[model samples]
Target: MGMIKDAQVSVRDLFRWRQRTVTVDEQGNEHVTFETPSTPPNPIRLLRSISMLGWGAYLIGFFCWTADAFDFHALSIQTVKLSQHFGISRTEISTAVTLTLLLRSVGAAIFGIFSDYFGRKYPLTVNMWILGALQVGSIYAPSWNTFLAIRALFGLGMGGVYGAAAGMALENIPVEARGLMSGIFQQGYSFGYVLAACTNLGVGGATSSWPIMFWVGAAMSFAAGFARLIFPESKQFIEARQNSKGSSTAQFAKNFGKMLKLEWKVCVYSIILMSWFNWFSHTSQDSYTTFMLVGKELNNAAASRASILMKTGAVVGGTFVGYFSQWLGRRRAMIIACFMVCCLIPAWILPETESGLEGGGFMLQFFVQGAWGVVPVYLSEISPPAFRAIFVGLTYQLGNAISAPSTQIINALSDSHTIRNHTGRVVAAYGPVMGIATAIIAVGLALTAAVGPEKKGASFESAAAATTAEAVTDISAAAAPSKAHQSSSVGQATSEEDLAGKKGANGDSHAVLTKTEYA
Candidate 1:
């Protein structure tokens, strides 16, 4: 014990964790240290290496996505123009959109895994460049085949962008700022939609050729690509890379293994919640608003205004949704969002006459926009870094896939029906169905809320903040400490220390809950 005390005084390891002392005997020597398990940390933070230039570059990626969304309705309506140029049937032209979605999902899966391997910046920049090239090629597609292929190819880039961008965002920001910052970042599309609407509205959608939209897409994609060319790899990605050995392949598999270990029940519930609520929200809200204008038989200007108003409202609503989530909690916020849609859906469907359409469109867009923002913030909080990219890709692209089919099915149903009294009420007809579906899922969520969403303030734990000094003080109170020198335990403290590190500062970085991360 005498020799142990001296050696312990200058031991192999000394950590301060909360306010506790830990002195253990090892190899006939005393090892003394301190550790603090519950010492709340300063918050996770990123170095300011990424300046405003990086943000601008990062933001342009979102702009490309937004432009595509704005062009969707116009493109769908431009079947005649598209058909003439593409030399295919309406069905074939439609496949361009459908396949784009399908392939985008595939791209997300591939690149999401790749981002976990190759680093976020390079993949993101490469994808942006590809998107730009495709957008430009799309501008001059000589036939339907060429156009369809280009669009489908573009989906790969688009898909890659989502996960890579998310990975990049989360990789750089402060831990405490993660929730709110991510909330904002995820809602970029809704805001982008507003920008798209403004472009269309300002330039006059009818006067503008459809090709201009792709030009817009190309420009934004190129801008982002060029800008990100200079950005650094995410620091988090670097840390993850360091922890890894052998091959990126091994790490990826390990990540997948962790994801597989996730509580199956939680996984299922998350998928359901994401798919049902998310799909319907897009279908019921965005699709309806655009279609409602056409249904109202309103002139071009009024139609454009209606679209503009709805998306503008969406932008405003999305921006504030995170604040609401902070108070109500993510799960409850989701529940309330669905409930809000259910109640307002009636209003959306029953605005009665043309004049009332504006009010209906305005009211429904609020929830549609707001509910979406809450989703990203909630999911990221639950995801751990290891598998965040994959889960983000899966949930987001999967949800989009569900909605894409639902959109097709609803369009088929609407055109199939004929009601003399319901002549202009076609768009509204889909609302209650979506609202009902959402409500049912929302109920299941409330029932399993405990398992699905993560604890909001739980990011307080940072891996870096755990130290030996604090650890030793907390343990010393037992006072009757006696242990024969036995074995040695390394004080590397990988997992818990990282948790402390994550507490650095919260920023709106993209955090998507990957099953691996959750595990």
Candidate 2:
């Protein structure tokens, strides 16, 4: 009943233009409050709050992420062509997809930690260059074995992009705009798919034209790398680095170990949640074009058009739902989106005509990616201060690693079953296989989201400040002569006047510090 009432209020507030505020109590705990604003800030006002530099960072992140998606979807969208080129079964081609996803966790772990410690710019730039070079490698692979190997290597660079990109994109935005921006940011994946589809359409269905798409993907990757070069490090990261100037590599490692020890549960939960999300998107999308061509007997152009429309729905749905999540609350928004997706599974895979398929596909992906829009900010909120990049990237890629076999699994299942298509020809039962799999995944996702934690509107700045303050304190303590001296130093460091000044200046750092001490 309490949950029901909260849901009702959230729904009501969605229409009311409420503003969220955070207040600190005497004990240095933050309390979030929402109240109706006299007039909602217009989009221009919201955009103005982010400033030009913030937008630059956000756009660069978005562009790199989009390029990552394009490189990935290029292969998935052209699976049939690739299978023909390699003279192998479609399932065999999917093995490359599986291998690529399976190794992303390694890349994420390596580059995520690097970005967190050094900076996002260099690691991200290098990752893009690596992706470009690998795409070029894929273009000229001499044989089946060589193609598979290159794709597996491509996964490493691909894995590192999301964490750093997400950290750079969302960390600098105002809290009020994060939901809207997160939705738009996440749609880079869908947009990449749309772009891939358009490229596929333009190049025609000739088997030889597949390499053209790879070339395009390589160019995009290189472009994203160059674009990132024009941007500087994130402002929040710079400030945090300045504040923790005394910390050494050994202390950094020790702090990371302590974070893992204390926040292991959150880490585990994030990985589990991300696994479901990965499965959710890949299961619905990876084989969709193949499903159209094989099950519905559509031609390449028809399939590409349907794919574009479907992902267009994804972009629109993700943006709206992501924006609404600000008022709907993160968990509630995700739960609702997952439920809608489950309801749409039948329509998503059952249409016969091209128009019907396009409509259903669009609506289905709208909700599918809608749930994904909350992920960037939600992950950021849950991550420990000083580890946002690694936490977000590693968890997301680990989830990808776990769900790496999604496309292969779907292909294998479909090949074993036979179903009659619209023209009365027997084909792989992709529709039923994909539909059943998606339904089960959607239900599980909704349940997982319902039970999972939320830290909506969490202050990244406050957390960074708290971590910096703690690092400074540790340094002072290490330099002290004795235990009594350390205690006196600590007391002086956290004197009431100093604490009050910090609270007055930042309003939430003191609360974050209090929580960090106990955590």
The list of candidate 2 runs beyond 4 A from truth reads 1-41, 464-519
lDDT of each residue in 146-245, candidate 2, tens digit only: 9999999999999999999998888889988988899999999899999999999999999999999999999999999999887887787777677555
| Number of the top TM-score candidate | 2
What RMSD, rounded to one decimal, does every model reach? 12.2, 7.0
- Superposition error at 87 for model 2 (Å): 0.4
Candidate models: Cα lDDT each:
0.51, 0.80
Clashing pairs in 2: none
TM-score of 1: 0.70
Cα distance off (Å), candidate 2, residue 124: 0.5
lDDT of each residue in 1-519, candidate 1, tens digit only? 422332232222222222112222211111222232332322223224345644554455455445445434445544434555655654455566666666767787877777766766777777777877887898788776777788778767667776667656544444434444555666566655555555555554453366776677567777777666776666555653454344445544654554445334335545665666555554555445334544444554565566666666666666566545554455555556656766776666655465566676666667666677666656555543345565666667765665556555544454444333355444333444445554564455444433343335433122110111221221222122234211222221212322333332331111111111121
**Model 2: residue 290 alpha-carbon error in angstroms:** 0.1
Task: Tell me the TM-score of each prediction against the true structure.
Answer: 0.70, 0.86
Cα error, candidate 2, residue 97 (Å): 0.5
- Model 2: weakest 10-residue lDDT segment is 510-519
